[model samples]
Target: MKWVTYDAGSGPRTGILDGPTVRGLGAGVTLLSLLGDDGERLAEAGAAARTAPTEVRPLDEVRLLAPIPRPPSIRDGLCFLDHLRGCYRAMGRGGELHPAWSQTPAFYFGNPAAVVGPYDDVPIAPGCELFDFELEIGAVIGRGGRDLHPDTAEEHIVGYTFYNDWTARDHQLRDMAQGIGMGKAKDSAITLGPALVTADELEPYRSDGRLHLEVSATVNGREVSRGTLAAMDWTFGELLAYLSRGTDLLPGDVIGSGTVPGGCLLEHVDTPDMAGFSGWLRPGDVVSLQGPALGHTRQTVRPAPPMIPLRTGC
Candidate 1:
């Protein structure tokens, strides 16, 4: 069944997606509360929510937070070959370091506090010249384990959700060249939600033609980058297995499956013919992603809160 983390009257809540309707779980219905336990608890919660006859809310009324809003931690995997290729081409770079694109997934930690609701505003950092957005799929871990075999990786997954790995290419390129990544790729750079669809419900999407995924990002109602899910080089299963090796996997952890090819501004480098294509995003730009089954969410770019200025005394 499809699961969602939503806002009830008081705070965040967890529920099952019954068509466009949402059926909330028992008291204390946050997804983290459910997935933080063994798989048995999750199943029990699902059953309870299914038969409880809860009030069904329109998908838009209640805000949709990241599946695991404050997941113990997040490790986004760089396993999509098409995205890697385009990234390199845009930068005039060369072959990938990982030949098979199967090496340990290159991942990074995202800010837990900045986790956004389905239709939240995304800050566009001032002075960032090349702002870009990516459409990705994030997998939520259900069980904790270490050195998990490839075949058993899926068992640990609880569900899937849409991700907008919003990026600032200018900062990223500068930091990467220095062998470090910090302000360039942290906190608030990621956007996720709408709801999490349990793993069992997403199995059908794994088939060749069934995935038929398409991602489109529009700026102020004009289309920019667009791509299909069929182009991903590595499947989610492979990335999970590779990451689990020799490392402890925990519940409520998120694994972001990088961006899709041509899914951002970096790919349209110095092209005049690409009208309405501007690399840098200014405040007031509205970005949105739409997929087949996953509903669409929009983020309006706004100025970030002012930072405290540093003072010095001689």
Candidate 2:
């Protein structure tokens, strides 16, 4: 079932998206609250919601929010080999996979508080000129577990949503040059949602132990990049198992499937045509990331607030 957290005339509330109408799941029932239990219960609730007589509203009448506005934690895994290779090449490093990449999934923790809804405006970071967006899919945790075996990892996932890991590429490259981590470079706003498609609803897209979904990104209504989820070098189950090792995976935690191959401008900016562009993203640009199973997230780029002066001498 497709689940959405939206705000109508009142406030944010959970609902099931049936066709073009939203069937309210009652007040105070946020997506995070529904995720706090097994997917079976959530599915049951959705079944009831579909058949129950309730106040229904046009989908366009309500504003959609990130399925889990405040997820417990956000971890993004670098599971696509091609994306990594392209990123390294973009940074002037050779496009070769590191030996460690084949051994395990590499990931970074993202700021949960920086998350914005699908239709929200993303402020370009102050002093950032090379802004970019990573097109990815996010798996939301349904049940908590520790040291979960790879074979059992799929059981922990509840649903999926489209994710945009917005980045300030200039800051990211500078930090890498100085051997600093991605803390500040990636702490900016990340976007998720439109709606979360539960795992059961995605059965048709599963094949060869991987999801067969096309992922794409469009800027200003023009397609910029495209790739398929089947190209991921590491499966979500493997990433989840690796993440659960010695750590408890909590409900509402989000695990991203990294950027897909050719999913971001960073990998293509060096091309002759793309290099002519002055800024990576400008005010009024609309970026939309879409997947067949997971709904699309559309964000409008907005100018950043004026920089706050930093204190100099002590």
Candidate 3:
């Protein structure tokens, strides 16, 4: 079942996406609450809602929001070796990936408060010159767990959604020199949604223990990058196990698959492939991502507000 959170003038409500229509599951129910809903009650309720005509609306008429607007937490992992390889190439660092990358998936927490709706305008990071978007998949946790095993981690995932891990390349690079955190480089925006598709809905695209869906991205109506989720060297299950080693993963938590290979402009910036185009995202630039089952979304890049001056600069 594909789920959505939308507002139809009144307020935000949980809904089931059925083709051209969005069937609102009524008041008091939120996508966050549904993540922890046990038994067959949700299914039965969704079934019942489909037959009723009370809150159903055309998909184009309602305002869509991220399935779990403000996730409890966001864990983004470097699961795709291609993205790593691309980064290495862009940075002129000639070496194979770290041995630990093959043994365990490493991840960083993102700001949940930075999340925005699919169609929301994404502002360029303040004080950043190289704004970019990362195309990837995000798995939403349905059940909370600790020290989970990789083999059984899939059971805890409720659904998957298209994730845009927006970044500020210059800020990230500068912060790397400090050997510190990402700072505000990735704190600006993270777009999610259109619809959260459950596992069963994406069954047709699953292969080799990973999703083989056709993923493509474009900026300003020009094709920037394209690839499949199967390009990932690590699996979400493995990522879950490593990330949950000592920490608890709660319902409403989102696990990002990092950026897919060739999924972001930073990877193509200095490359011959994107040579003619400016790699950084600019104001009024429209960025889009698409995949089968998982819905598509387009967001226009808006200008960043004036940069806040640092009084105590180093």
Candidate 4:
């Protein structure tokens, strides 16, 4: 079943998306709350909710919000070798893949407070001239667990959603030069939405031994990047297991699949066809990311505010 969180004049509420209309499950109910409950029971309740006579709202009449507006935690993983190689080469680092990448999955913690909805405006980072987007898929954790094995990690996932990992290239490079990690560069803004597709709904696509989902991004209605989830070097189960090592993962926690090959502008700016394109996102530019089972997330770029300087005290 497809689940959505939207506001219909009252407040954020949970609903099941049926065609172009959204059937309300309950007032004040949220995706996070549903995820915290038994997965089987939640599915049963959702199935019943879809058939019962309830308040139904047209999709256009409501404002869609992030499935879990404030997720418990956000972890983004770098699981695409093609994207990594391109980025390293573009940044003047060698194109050779890191040896550790083949043996282990790597990820970074993103700020949950910066999460935004599908149609929200993304403000350009102040003093940042090179803003970019990373097209990704996010797995939402259902059951909390620690020291989870790879074989059992899939049981902890409830559903998946589209993720747009916004980036300020300038700030990110500066942070890398100073060895300060992602810091403010990545924590500024991230979008996740449209709807969350449950694991059961996506089981058919898993027959190929990999998640066979197509991912693509468009800027101002012009398609730019494309890749497949099958390109991921690491699977979601592996990343989840790695994250659970000596750590506890709770319900409502989100883990991202990272950027697919050619998913970001930084990787394509030097290509022959894209050589004339400007690498930075401009105000009023709308970026839409779409996938097969997972729905689409569209974000409009808003003008940047005046840069706030860091105060240096004596």
lDDT string for model 4 (1-314, tens) is 88888899989888889999998877766778776655976786697678872579999999999989999999999989889999988878869986899998989999999999999999988878899999999999988888888876978999888999999998898888888568768978889888888888888888656778887999887778888878889888888999999999999999999898888888877778575565579998899998778878888999878886777520
TM-score of each: 0.87, 0.95, 0.95, 0.95
Question: Residue 227 deviation, candidate 2, in Å?
Answer: 1.2
The reply for model 1, stretches above 4 Å from the true place, is 36-38, 53-55, 94-104, 208-212, 307-314
What's every prediction's RMSD, in angstroms?
Answer: 3.1, 1.9, 1.6, 1.8
The lDDT of each candidate is 0.72, 0.86, 0.85, 0.86
TM-score of predicted model 1?
A: 0.87
Give per-residue CA lDDT, model 2, range 61-176, as digits (tens): 99999989999999999999899898888879889876999999999899999989999999998778888888999999999899998887988899889989999888787778
What ranges in model 2 sit over 4 Å off? 177-180, 272-279, 312-314
- The TM-score measured for candidate 4 stands at 0.95
| 240-277 per-residue lDDT for model 1 (tens digits) | 78777788888888888788766677766755636755
Tally clashes: model 1: 1
User: Any residue pairs clashing in model 2, and if so which?
Assistant: none
**Residue-pair clashes, model 3:** 0
Report backbone clashes per prediction.
Answer: 1, 0, 0, 0
